[model samples]
Target chain A: MKLNLRVWRQQNTDAEGAMATYEVDGISPDMSFLEMLDTLNEDLILRGEEPVAFDHDCREGICGACSLVINGDAHGPERTTTCQLHMRSFRDGDTIDVEPWRASAFPVVKDLVVDRSAFDRIIQAGGYISAPTGSAPEAHATPVPKPDADSAFEHAECIGCGACVAACPNGSAMLFTSAKVNHLNVLPQGAPERETRVLDMVAAMDDEGFGGCTLTGECATACPKGIPLPSIAAMNREWLRATRKARR
Target chain B: MTLGPSVGLMALATRTERRTEPQPSMTRIFWRSTVGKKTVMALSGLIMLGYLVAHVMGNLKIFFGPGEFNAYGHWLRTMGAPVLHHSWALWIVRVGLLAAVIGHAVSAYQLSRRDIKARPTAYVHKRPRASYATRTMRWGGIILALFIVWHILDLTTGTVHVGGFEEGRPYQNVVDTFSTWYGNVIYIVAMLAVGLHVRHGFWSAAQTLGAGNARRDRALKAMANGLALVLTAGFVSVPVAVMTGVVS
Candidate 1:
């Protein structure tokens, strides 16, 4: 298969960027999206051109590093992460426009590489088990309900890819923040820091220059992990309840 | 420091150009940018909702006595446009309210357009048997707008021509309007519109603000639905009581 690619190119954080077009021929249909990019980069290097700078580590979609906005949809119009996307999704002579996440909160660090450190900051704000980690307690000692455990695990699936942040009109990472907050906050071990977690995480999210949630469900739609929008609401309710409780 | 004729002419031209071109005010700023519009809508909508809650609470004072209720209205009018009994405070609030309504409507319009373009057949797979409130979001919003306009004309502007209002008995006019079966029915229908609008609006706004979570989406939805029910019930009860001769 042969394809046309219009990929964003920026030398550094301060460099102005443009979509630089390239052609990739003789690509196998079964090749992964990253593999295809790798082949293209091999060609670029052979021609003495600087290889396109992009983020990819595991190439299995678990690392949350192979991030790209393909053809205007985050993760290339597929329901999975970029690394999980395959060449079969495209056709011969297909033209794909690839760019990094375009958001003030997620600034481009280089070509197809964005600084998603804001998410890390937000997670650090409250997305943790504050209880001492040295204890050797049995896993079933707290006796978590099956439903709660299942729900926690579902929210725990979030990889903090910043896809929700990018897709949101408000540039809000609320879904991402909420998933992390709720994941731990719902558990017995997470109770001690629940109130503080809600407050600090919310404040951190605001400080990261992310917009407030409008509840359009766009984040959920764009999410490669299928993170639900409801998690944010739970965070909000928890925050409201915590504030009131604290006031009392 | 020699002021040549061309310099004077150039200065005059620059001054004229500056004067003719209106400076970009906050309203202009809001209208010119999407972020500005979102901010305006969020702030204004919250204010308007607060006002609505306050207004409902105050109007319920009619259950106390005609004098007490009328005094409350008189006090409100006194605060807005002052010495001539017109309170500037009221004008500020009125302007704020107008801004909220206009901003909400305008932003909603743009969002609705984008939504359409984003998913040309979004509701194609939507079940036809979905709740009336869920399916009628657009219709409910329109109906609520019409209801608001009618309410302003009937009570505030005195243009609806209810009998006792023109005779200097605004409280009695309200009672009379609610006492009639048809008027009571219209009021109930309008409240239903408010209920439907709020049902979707609350969560939708939250999403727009980026407050969603996968875990809490359903819970927030249930809570929003409950809020809508309570609000509708509160507003509907007043007219229902009057029609049933419970208030008269």
Candidate 2:
């Protein structure tokens, strides 16, 4: 398949960026979106031109390292990560526009790459359990109810890909932070620090300058891991409970 | 290689060091946190929603004839007759509604500015995202605000009334306001905006307040739709009746 691409190009973090057009021919339907970019880069290299830059690792899609807003939708027209999106999803001669994630918290590093370290800082705030580090505990040592375990596992699927921020009109990180909070806060092992975990992580998220949630559901729609939108509501419940408890 | 004695001593010293600082007040923390701000938005929005429900019900009383409607309007002023002074209850309600409006607007404005700032750049390819109600929230809110100002001037203050406005006779004032073509146009347009706003706002508030979940999602959505429909239809019926000479 042949395709026309309008890819965002930035020289560096401080440089101005714009969409640069290119035409690629002889693309196969089986090629992943990243592979298609590879083909474009190979052609650019052969032509002695600077290639488009983007973030991608573990193309298998679990790493959450790949970030791209393809044709105005994060991860393109498909409901999956950019690396997992196939060329067959597009028709021949289609003009595709690619751009980096746009959020002040996730600044563009270069071209289609944005710094997502804000997510890391939020995680560091309190997205973990307070378990002792001496040795691994037996799996059955703490009995987790089936429902709680299921809920925890469901929230644990968040890959921190930042698509929620990219897709949110407000550029809010509520969905991402909520996923991390719920993943651990539901488990028996995470009970000791439940209140502080939510309180501190939410504070960290705000300090990072991300926007507030408007419940547009754009974040859930853009999420590759299928983190449900209700997870945010659950987090809100936890935060409110913690705040009331702290006050008392 | 082994660590030097000085390095080991330095690590121990740093580990033992603790920084002491006063914790921020809970109010300061709540206002600063995005989640807290959203909680405020939810509460304020619900307050306004409650007011709308009451306002629509009061408005529908016009169909019972001018005598009944005018009596209801007079009762509004003398609502707390024996205990509270005349118009005191009305003033209290006005003050409460004003507070809710201010809280809702302030948070929305601040959050919107942050949201816009967070996503400094726009995507090269623009496709519509989210539902129509979701997308129209900001603009719809602005429309409702302007309508409120106009509504107060036309009816309450008599400043913008089309015809001679009386102080207590709300039935005639309502008829006079709806008598004008521009009045009908503005009222209908704003009512539509109200519908769209409430359709998304109600459900969004539920999520923000953590009152929503998978089990209650369907019921919450239905309630939002029901409220939007009832309020819009009830409010718009006044003008429609006046236009058709059914109420006048």
Candidate 3:
């Protein structure tokens, strides 16, 4: 099968980008979307032209490194991660437009890759427990309620892929920050830093120039990890409690 | 391994610099983030929804005749008895409702602006995964705003009332407002918008205020739909009754 791809191309962060058309034929129905891109790059390399650059580390969807907005969605035609999306979803002669995450914080690095270090900075602000890094404590040392542990683990599924940022019309990072905040704050071990975690991380999020959440919910839909929208509300609860506690 | 005197001086300097960094109040910090704004939107929406529920219940009193509806209107003013002046309780409710409206509008406007700022560039091929109600929020809000102004003019202030506008006769004024075709049109259209807004807003408010989860997702959705349907039926019932000569 053959597909027409309009891929965004940029030489560097400082360079202006545009959509470059590529016609790739003989694509297998079983091939992943990224594999299809690899085939395109291989053809470009053989032709002595600059290959299209895109980010991919795990190719298994666990590593959130593979980022692309396919046909206007954060991942591609499917809600799954870019790497996990199979070529069979599209028909022969289909036109697929691929582009980097369009956000002020995540600037285009080369082609499909956008710098996602802003997320790292937010995590650095809090997103952790400050217990000494030594021999790990026994899992059962802290008796966490099953419900809280389950909720925490669910939020912990977030891969920090910036899909929430990319999917949001406002490019808001609330869902990402909320997931990180709730993942720790819901657990017994995270109680000590709960109040400060929401504060510092939220501060970091704003400092990074992300957009505000309007409850449009495109982020949750686009999230590969299926992070629920309630995580953000949980973060809101945390922030309110933290604010009131700080006031006292 | 260490430059003792210089390091000591540097530590002191760092401490001084840290101290000089401004410590923003928790309220300021909370209101600055998208999560905070979402919380405000949710809380305010809940407040308005509560008011609508109560208002619709009061409207149902019209089914009991003019004496009952008039008495109900009078009762609203004397809510606090001799302990508090007449209409004082009503004024308090009014003030609160006004604040909620202002909070909802201001947060929505600000967040919309921020959302746009987050994405300087839009996707070349855009496809949204959000619900229809969520997509129509901005226009729905505007329609509701315009409706409120016309509603107040037609009924509350009677500035644009078609028939004889009688003071203190809440039943007659309501009937008079509905008697006109324009009144019914505006009121019915507004109610439809309200239904859509509540259908989306109620569920969203639950998520924003930390009252939602995967287990309760369906229940929350049901409740939202129920509320929207009930409100629309409840509010629209009066106008329909007037048109059918059941109330008038």
DockQ of each: 0.08, 0.72, 0.55
Which is superior by DockQ, 2 or 3? 2
TM, every model: 0.61, 0.95, 0.91
Q: Is the docking of candidate 2 incorrect, acceptable, medium or high quality?
A: medium
Taking all chains together, the TM-score of candidate 1 against the true structure is 0.61
For model 2, name the residue pairs that clash: none
Give stretches of model 3 more than 4 Å off.
A11-16, A137-149, B1-22
Best by DockQ: 2
Residues B107-208, candidate 3: write the lDDT tens digits: 999878877788999999966557888888878998998898888888888999877888789999999888889889989999999999999999888877
lDDT of 2 at B29: 76
**Residue A195 local lDDT, model 3:** 86
TM-score of 2: 0.95
Per-residue C-alpha lDDT of model 2 across residues A31-130, encoded as one tens digit per residue:
9999999999999999999888889999998999998999899998888999999999999999999999988999888889899999999999888876
**Model 1 per-residue lDDT at B130:** 31
lDDT of 3 by residue, A142-208 (tens): 8999999899999999999999999998888989999999999998889888888888898899889
Error of 3 at A177 (Å): 1.4
Output the better candidate (1/3) by lDDT: 3
Candidate 1 Cα errors over 4 Å, as ranges: B1-155, B158-200, B205-248
